[model samples]
Target: MKDKLKKLIIIPAYNESECIEKTIENIQKNAKDFDYIIINDCSTDNTREICERNGFHIINLPVNLGIGGAVQTGYIYGIRCGYDMAVQVDGDGQHDAAFLQKMAECLEETGADMVIGSRFIEKQGFQSTGARRIGIRFFTWLIRLMTGKTVTDPTSGLRMVNRKVMAKFAKDYPKDYPEPETAVTVLHCGMKIKEIPVVMKERAGGVSSISMQKSVYYMVKVSMAIIIERMRRRK
Candidate 1:
C-alpha cells in the first residue's frame, strides 16, 4: 500500500543556505522514493542561488512568507500534481530523511489523516532547554484539554498530511505560529491525528528563527490562535 502512494517531501526553507544542500542530499540518499520540492520563502541570503546552482526543484516566493505560508505553497503543488500524501521536513537539517518512509507507512497502517513525527513520544534526541520544554508541555496539555487529543510534540514541524487535509491547508493554512494551531484545526475538522516517535537533530546550520525574545510572543500568539479556532466552524 505504501509503495502505491504518491508521496512528496516539502522543505520549507527560510535563509537556510548553509544547510539546504545537506538536507536535500540526505533526502536523495535516504528517501529516493519520494519526490521533493524546496519552498524558498524569499530568503535574504543566497538560498535561491544555491538551489538554482544545484538544479533542485523549488518554488521561490517573491516576498518573505512565514513558515506556514511556505508549507502551504508545497501543499498546493502536491495537490495540483496529484499526490496522495505530503510530508513536511525542515530545511535546517533537523529532521532526518530516514524517518520519512516510516511516517508514510504509519499513515497507511493506522489510516490516519495526519502523522506527526514526535521527539517526546520516546523522549529521545535533542530535547531542547527546560524553558522550551515547559512551553511544549503547556501546549500539550492545552491541546488535550481543548480537543481531547494528546500531542507530546505539538510544536513539531515534521508532519505528513493526506490529500483531504492537504487541500484544505492549501486554501487556508495558518499564517504565523501555525503548527500547534493547525493541530487544533485538524481535530475540529474531525480528522484523525497520530504521533510517532522519531529522533531529531539540532539544526545543522544557521540560528533558529525563534529567538528568546520572540519565544514568549510565539507562545501567547499560538495559544490564543488555538483557543480561538475552537469557536470557529470547521471547513
Candidate 2:
C-alpha cells in the first residue's frame, strides 16, 4: 500500500525563539496529521535549542541565509527524505496551521504543483501595510503578465508544494524577495499554481526582519530581479 501520510511541514526560522515554540505547538495541535521539520537559519536566539528541546526535526544552517535560502534548504531536505509533498510555514507565528489541511487537500485533489495560502483571496483578516500591499499587488500584476495567471497573494509564506516543485526549487532557488520570483519560476517550468483563502494574524513576538526601509529596498531589488530573471529565461 502507498504511504498515506507523505507530507512534511517545513518551517523556516531565524531568531524566532519568542514564537518558535508556540508555532511548533500550534502546528502539532492543528496539523498532527503531517510530519514537521524546522530549518533553523543560524538564529542568534535560542530557536535551535528550543526546537531540539521540543523534539522537532531540525536542520541548522551555519549562517543566516534569509527566508529564501532557509526554505530552499527545507525543500532540498524534503526531496532527499522522499516526502511526496512539502509545505512551507513561517516560524514567526503569522501563518495559520489550521489551513495546512485545506492547502494539502487542494494540492492532492487538484494535482497542482503548488498551492499558496492567500490572505487576500477572501479578505478575511488584518491585511498587510499600505506600501507592502501595493508592492504585493504590483508583483502580482507582474507575475500575471509573465505567467498569464492572476495570483491573489504573491508574497504569502504559507504554501504547499509537491515533490516535483521541491525538486525544481532545490536545484535553483531565488535569493532575495523569493515569493514573487518563485511563483514566476514555477509557472515558467510549466507547473500549475493555485491560491486558497487563509486568514493570517499579526506576528506573535519580536519585530519583523523586514523594516520600512528594508521593504522599500525589497520592492526595488525584487522588481529589477524579476525582470532580469524573465529576460535571462527568454535567452
Candidate 3:
C-alpha cells in the first residue's frame, strides 16, 4: 500500500520568501517519493518568484485567501490530479516534513481519514509559548465537548487526509478557525482521526498572522466557530 499510494504535500504559503525554499528543501530530503505543491497565496513578497526560479510545482492564488482558502485550493488540486492522500504543511518552516511519511503510514495502517502531527503529544521541540498553549488547551476542551475527540493540538497545521475528506474540504471548508472546526466536521462525518507525536521547529522567518494582541480575538472567534460547526454537523 505504501508503495502504491500517491501522496501530495499541500503547503499553504503567504509571504514566506525567507522560509519557503527551506520548507521545500526539507520535503525533498525527507519525503522524496511524495509530490508537493506550493499554494502561493498572493504573497506581497517575492515568494512566487522564488518558487518559479526553483522550478517547484506551484499554484499561484490571485488574492490572499488566508490559510483556509489556500489549503482548500490544494485539496481541489489534489482531487483533480487523483492523489490518494494529501497533507497540509505550513510554508513558514515551522512544520517539519520528516514526520510526513510517518503520518502517511499511520493513515494507511489505521485506516484513518485524517492524521495530525501533534507537538503536544510528546511535548518536545519548540512547543509554542505558554499563552498559545493556554489557547490550545481551551480549544482542546472545546473540541472534546463538541465531538468527544481529544486533540492535543487542534491548531496544528500538520495534517494528512485521505481522498474522501480531501474532496469534502475542497467543496466546503471554513475560512477561520479551520483546524478545530474541520476536526469537528470530520468527526461528525463518522471519520476516524489519529495523531502522532512530532517536534515542530520555531518559525525560521516571517511574522505570524496571529499576534499577541490578536490572541484573545483568535480564541473567542475560534471557540464560537467550533460551536457553530458542531451545530452544523451532518445528521
The order of the candidates by lDDT, greatest first, is 1, 3, 2
Q: Which sections of candidate 2 miss by over 4 Å?
A: 1-5
Scored by lDDT, model 2 comes in at 0.87
- Backbone clashes, each candidate: 0, 0, 0
lDDT per residue (tens digit) for residues 117-162 in model 2: 9999789886888977988899989887876889989988888999
User: Could you give candidate 1's per-residue lDDT for residues 1-235 as a string of tens digits?
Assistant: 6677899999999999999999999999999999999999999999999999999999999998898899999999999999999999999989999998888988889989999999998889998789989999999999998898999999999999999989999999988778899999999889999999999999899888789999999999998898889867543
Query: Which candidate gets the maximum lDDT versus the true structure?
Result: 1
TM-score winner, 1 or 2: 1
Error of 1 at 117 (Å): 0.4
* Model 3 error, position 196 (Å): 0.4
| Model 1: ten consecutive residues of lowest lDDT | 226-235
lDDT (10s digit) by residue, model 3, range 66-145 = 88999999999999999999999899899988998899889999999999999997799999999888888988999899
Model 1: pairs clashing at backbone N, Cα or C within 3 Å = none
Location of the lowest summed lDDT over 10 successive residues in candidate 3? 226-235
TM-score of 3: 0.97
Q: Could you report the Cα RMSD, in angstroms, for every candidate shown?
A: 1.4, 1.5, 1.1
Q: Give the TM-score of candidate 2.
A: 0.95
**TM-score, predicted candidate 1 vs. hidden true structure:** 0.97
